[model samples]
Target: MLKDFKAFIMRGNVVDMAVGVVIGASFGGIVKSLVDDVLMPPIGLLLGRVDFSNLYLILREGTAPGPYAALAEAKKAGAVTLNLGLFANTVINFIIVALAIFLVVRAVNRLQAMQKSKEPEAAPSTRECPFCASTISIKAVRCPQCTSALAE
Candidate 1:
């Protein structure tokens, strides 16, 4: 059982999957940062300084008051709110990640196709008979077309 477990852990696919998981987690962090810090800031500026992260609808007033400056403030006050800005940012992040994965998969598929095309084809399984000049199986001991004896 121990040896079997070790073999499963050491398999190429398993190792590759583990590596992919690590990379994917790191990529998620980067995408999150890009959406929140890089993309949203500029977009908000273009839309008259509307901070997306703070865009929310309060269902119930918190302990503090009715009006809250930011989502953090509302949360700190224990307010029940619908976080629309954060959702938008997450949706954008997902789109970017999905597009990136699609491009990577497409490129990999194209490269695999190119490699397959470059590979040499399997050797022919048939040869021409010398006497009759007829196509015959390579293992034939006699010419079937002309009924002639063939040298071994």
Candidate 2:
């Protein structure tokens, strides 16, 4: 049972899956950072300086007064809030990751197609006899039908 378990864990597919999971998690973090730090700021600036991360709805008022400065402050003050900005950022991150994966898969498929196209095709080994118009193997020394000596 221990040997079987070791074999299962060491299988190529299992190892590949484990590596893929780890890389995918790291890639997700990168995509998230790209969306939050790189893309959103410029987009927000173009859209009249609207900060996506700050866009939220206050369900319940904070302890002090009307408007809470930030989401953290609102949460700290025990205010119920809908963090729409963070949700938007997450959605963007997903889109970026999905697009990147799509591009990678597309490139892999193209490479596979090119490889298939470059493969050599099998050539026909039989030829028609000029005398009898019968098909004969190229290796035949004599025509079986007409008894003619074939040229080497």
Please name the candidate that would achieve the greatest lDDT relative to the true structure: 1
In model 1, the Cα lDDT at residue 49 comes to: 95
lDDT of 1 by residue, 1-152 (tens): 99999999999999999999999999999999999999999999999999999999999988999799889999999999999999999999999999999999999999999999999999888989988799998888888899888877
Tally clashing residue pairs in candidate 1.
0
Which digits, one per residue and each the tens of the lDDT, describe model 2 over residues 11-97?
A: 999999999999999999999888888999999999999889988999888786658878888888888899999999988888889
Q: Quote the RMSD, in angstroms, for model 1.
A: 4.0
RMSD of each: 4.0, 5.1
Residue 11 alpha-carbon offset, candidate 2, angstroms: 1.0
| Pairs that collide, model 1 | none
